[model samples]
Target chain A: MASRAAVKTVIMVAAVALAAATGLAGAGARAADADAVRRGEYLFNAAGCLGCHTDEKGGGKPLAGGRALATPFGTFYPPNITPDPEHGIGRWSDADFIRAFREGRAPDGSYLYPAFPYPSYTRMTDRDLLDLKAYLFSREPVAAANRPHDLSMPFSWRFLLAGWQWLYFDTRGPRPDDPAKPPEWNRGRYVVDALGHCGECHTPRTTFGGMEADRYLAGNPKGPNGDKVPNITPQPRFGIGGWTPGDITLLLETGLTPEGDVVGNAMAEVVRNSTSKLTADDRAAVAAYLQSLPPIGPPP
Target chain B: MDSRVVNALAAGSVAAFLYLGFGGLGAAATDGDPAALVKQREQTMKSMGGGLQTIAKFVKGEAGSAADVQAAVAAITEASSKDPAVVFPQGTAIGTADSDAKPELWQNWPKAVEYWNGLKPATAKLTEAANAGDRAQIAQALQGVSKACANCHEDFRQKKQ
Candidate 1:
């Protein structure tokens, strides 16, 4: 009888220990998920998702898009990215989300417009993209419907985007770290090129709207809102070679130039929303990355 | 009368008439040529920028004295205290080679006035801090002034292309 009692006690102890182990594992998973969301929030700001996704001027809900992006082609109203089942991206699976950034293809197998900036986003690592998705999914979903793009004629034809993508899209996976460079430099490149997507505006575009690969960050004569985006290359005359890393960091922090003048317009918005939100280390990294670039002069 | 004399008189009368019509309008607007007013306002803004630069130098410990900081504060205050309507008159909103003022400044006149008026309080705080000779306060106040400059420029000034 005592042996049977001992066996029952052993079974109860085993069950209790299993329950405890399971509970600990669940807590660990929750903590990891939280960390991912936090990291994703940082990436969201760096990627400038909020500025384009939300219509702050129109008093629309955050991530419930209605922002009008005026381009040479036509006005593009960014769709709602919030997690509402009816209107937003609530029903998107992990593969759907990944494919959206990686292939610039929607869950419905339709090609997304370049106006969504998936070309730059395509360079982001899978882990970073997943983390960003986690953060986005954690947000409060709104029932606001996505607005249709106001493109004219052939531009409105979604199928035609396949041709454009075929011509411009690199279809390459995440950018790999250069073994030759320091970790900081690699981080800077990832942030500036992939997450920040500075080239989308700073780099001049071809007649086909593809970024001119030869003249990266040289400057855009016709940028969004008809503003002439300045060259950020390290050129002494035309670019920011004269600026020290501290000057760049200060500009990112407060929009104040070394000349004591504050930046204005679209850049001002970038300063306020994106760069300002970055950690000091990240800002310094951006400075280092920019300072290291080959100095490209203005187009002759 | 000789044709030469008639031509001279006619030219003189036309010059007088043109001066009276346009000059009266200019006088009614801001008591001087609009271009000259733009130039003056530009100079005032430059002076403010120079003053801020001086303060920045002092903050960085690169150069300048406490007295210099006070002087810079004074200059910024004086420049910012000017009546916006007088300095930023309607005719000066055109984008010329000399003027950086955007047409939106006049389009949203009330908001422009508000931003211009905001500079006064910001500069006044800087003046107070500079007079105190507290470096930290002065730096903080300088941020306020910079923000005020940015607020106005964000909407009114044409960005460098």
Candidate 2:
């Protein structure tokens, strides 16, 4: 009779002390460091992970998977990245996470399907990957069950992914910024090239699924629903070269084109979930970065 | 005269003229070959599509409430496809908008039929929803019909900017 009540009190006090010590309760309100995590948080938001990883269940359960990404390649069921040790990335090592984010290689060295958009991810620098992990790990973990992907047989072979990576692997990381550019512009460039991975759909692909770097951001016919993902590079005719940086920022915030048409396919989802959540200044920064790229006209 | 009687008499006179009024002029005006027959049917549908657009604009403007929407939808339904030949011609699957419908629609006829037939049913639901005086139902029906239009367009019409 004495043991039961005493045990419960001790447990409750222990939990309270742990919560206060770890600062876990206030994680959402607090943006730690505004230094490293700030950069990582910016990278994550730009990458649009919250869009793809979370269907964002009622009241906004981030990283609880239900978002479906379809491309001509195949449907990729993005895994739950919540810090659940069993269903999410809680157990993933820094190396494993870096490999996945930077090289499109999974924790087990299997080539991650391109649906993960590793082509654009290959541009991420080592520092970028590390910071992203810190930001992600610091987040409050929501334990949601992972959904198994419904890929057909040829795609179901996870080991074959190794060979696919060997053919298309690009792990050199993003190129160093042109030294003449301002630091903010360089930061914006780093966000887009490595973490944002904008090219996975916008860039043209070779027969075997490698990015056609020269044709970067040119329109692609085989988009999420076969709706064209129009060129973002500054080609006046077919690309977004004509859009002012403000126009680009507006598109990110509202999913509406500068001309006021809404994006319908995969882009709409990105705008709805991730970009719309960014600060106006961040959206402008991303716009500025994209505007810097050379124009690549629509695919021939 | 009744409308039927007038139409019959007019048809007879036009035929008689085509037969005897001129030489190659009659044949040129009326294609006699099978290939040309299909083209004629599609041309007729296209010719009538303008009427649909005009009526659609009128109905869209008139629709501020549920009852008004029902009447508008009823008008649009008849315009969309009071007759089958308007939407699904034998030769082309260009749908309501274009004349040169592609062959893929017929190649994949079953799925294409699903898309084409859904238009009338969806439009009818819209009319019913409007009559029911439920703004939400009417909106749902409108969206449903629009989706059908997009589906058929994606399948049959050539991509244009």
Candidate 3:
């Protein structure tokens, strides 16, 4: 009886060992893909791709773009960015995807509208972009058809964006983090300026849709959909100057305000989808950086 | 009577008065006056806003009034617990002036109810945190309440007039 039990135990041990060895071999091959997808998921949220890419009215399918972004210029429907070969970016080369984000150029060599936010995204690092592409490619592809923009006359011309790009698009990537600042502050700056692109909506723009660098993050009076984006600068009267760092952090995480006012409209979407997903430390850093900004009044 | 007991009795009466003043608006809402209903909800929201600010002042150490904090939390709990459906019935969205409620609020009634429903838990948490007298917990709970308010307004409330 002892000899029979020993034989059974030996057989079970051998079977387990064989399964582990086989799994290890496959795990090594899949590990890199897994890492890239994880990194991509982080970048996708950080870059706020879902806000514009998803069709909000149609239940917001991930990356199956159809969100109509309204601007003073026109209402532009974001294209399908899913991995579907027919209706999405599946057939495009890595270079094509990179160029679209970095140079605002489509695979067919046509210029994209400024509404796509490539100008701000162009500041992202190459590695980040690559990881983002990997993440996007990993998503379940949906075959949603592309919708065209409703633009007035000349604005519909894709070639015209080239002239717009020449005026506003910076060839240089993001400016390096200030060495004088702490790593946390730098991270906050990177998230705000490069990843979150908070200035895109907060800062007032020039007549031709170029960001007015002088009025950076001071709150745009002529915001999207004609709503006034409130001043976020630390100005005591009009901006968030009176708020504590915790207040800002809470606002980012939960879209709540000291006045018991919840952040509304576009910012609500931002908190729900983008900034809320950030780590607590990262959100705190963002608050710290925002607090440190020179307190400026509303844009003239 | 013991002073603590007296204080409790006074607080309870004040709370009851405040509740009746605001809760009466809820009753007015059902009287078939959409305008009155809108006005009542707006007043309730304003009270919630005031309560939130009062607590924020305490959290920031701008105010050290324990009684104020207690009163604020009580008011917020009261205001938040009211069913937004009762306050924002059909046709309360009329008039192009003053009211910022969107017509889509009625069109998507179930979604509206969901938004209103989300408020209670946050306020309940706030009541616990405030009772505990922990500043950090209170601050966190305050955020919970604020987020709930902001989320609903984002979808249902119209742009400020």
Candidate 4:
């Protein structure tokens, strides 16, 4: 009886090993699909596409793109980015989508306004953009009509944006990282400069609505709606130089400042829909990158 | 303008200045000093903000004891219980240097008062949750408190540049 039991146990162990080997191969394929969607979702949130596109104030569908962005140039409405064939990106080939994201050119070859933030999105890697596309394609498509932007006179001419782009836009992706820098810092650089686009709000703009690269992350006095977006540089009095990485992580997670201030402006919306959903590791990366920025004084 | 008459007039002006500057006009000084009132209320608001941060630290499991949560909740409740009408005296609105309070706050005074009044129950719920050490309850109550603040600030508080 003991000999029979030992033989049966050996057979059971062999069968289990065989099943494990077979399952591992299938898991690899499944993991790729799952992983792409996950990464894309992260990019979507980090890029802040939904904040301007979605009509959250009107309880409209996500990415349907009806919210009006008030700018010095005019009020520009974001277009529907859902996968609907007629109304969204459903008809867009991968190349067309890439052109729009990287060059701010639509499938129809019209120049996209800078309000779409392609200047920052242009710095993203092709692989990351593809992953983001995969995630966007997986969403439910809404058939919302794209709204026309309300701009005055010459600003309404989309061709004028080409001149603006010539002055400010850099079509290249981020430069290769310094070999001496840690891999984590490089990763943080990619996330902060490209995907996160923190400088869009933090950096003051030039007279023609271009970023003032000299005072990067120094704060904008003429931010949207005439509100002063505080300087975030490490300046002692005006900037966040005093904030520790943990303090920043907490702010991203819970919208609570180290000084006990609850963010109530556009940042509150960002916290609710974007940064708060990011993983702790991603938040830490953001903190690391922000801390590395050159300390600059507030706008004069 | 005789010498004696001029001397009496100078003495009277000095007496009035001392009366107003010192504790002579006590009730009027307390209500009339808008800068002092604004400063006091701002300090109270800061204390409330600190309390919320402490509670959040506990909720995130970052650090802080249960006692700390209770203490924070107590501070919030104490700060929020003050009457908004008394705290926000007249002449504290827009154009006051360093004052972020908008004139719309005084225009829509009743609704403004309601926003502060709404915090009482929200903080009460927070106190109960903090004492019970229920993280979910505390988070929900915190959201309520945050909403109350946002609702008021959206209309009343001027955004700082």
Which lDDT tens digits does candidate 2 get at residues A174-219?
A: 7788799876678767656665677777777786667777887776
lDDT of 4 at A88: 90
Give one digit per residue, the lDDT tens place, for model 3 in B1-161: 89999999999999999999888964655565666666777788888888987888787787767678889989987887776766676777747336778888889888888878888998889888888889989888877777777776777775652
In model 3, chain B matches the true chain B with a TM-score of 0.76
Give the DockQ-based CAPRI class for model 2: incorrect
Candidates sorted by DockQ, best first: 3, 1, 4, 2
Q: How would you encode candidate 1's per-residue C-alpha lDDT over B1-161 as one tens digit per residue?
A: 99999999999999999999899876775466777788888888888888988888777566799999999888888888888887787788655547888998889889988988888898889989999999888877887787788787766777655
lDDT of 1 at B89: 74
On DockQ, the leading prediction is 3
Query: Per-residue CA lDDT of candidate 1, range A14-124, in tens?
Result: 999999999999999999999999999999999999988999868999999967999988899999999998899999998999999999999999999998888899999
In CAPRI terms, where does candidate 3 land? acceptable
Per-candidate local distance difference test: 0.87, 0.65, 0.82, 0.82
Candidate 4 residue-wise lDDT, B10-32, digit = tens: 99999989887775554554556
The complex in candidate 1 yields a DockQ of: 0.33
Better of 1 and 3 by DockQ: 3
| Model 4 ranges with Cα > 4 A deviation | A1-34, B1-44, B53-68, B81-156
Q: Each prediction's TM-score against the native?
A: 0.85, 0.56, 0.81, 0.76
What would the TM-score be for candidate 1 when compared with the true structure? 0.85
Tell me which of candidates 1 and 2 scores higher on TM-score. Answer: 1
Q: Which candidate is the best by TM-score?
A: 1
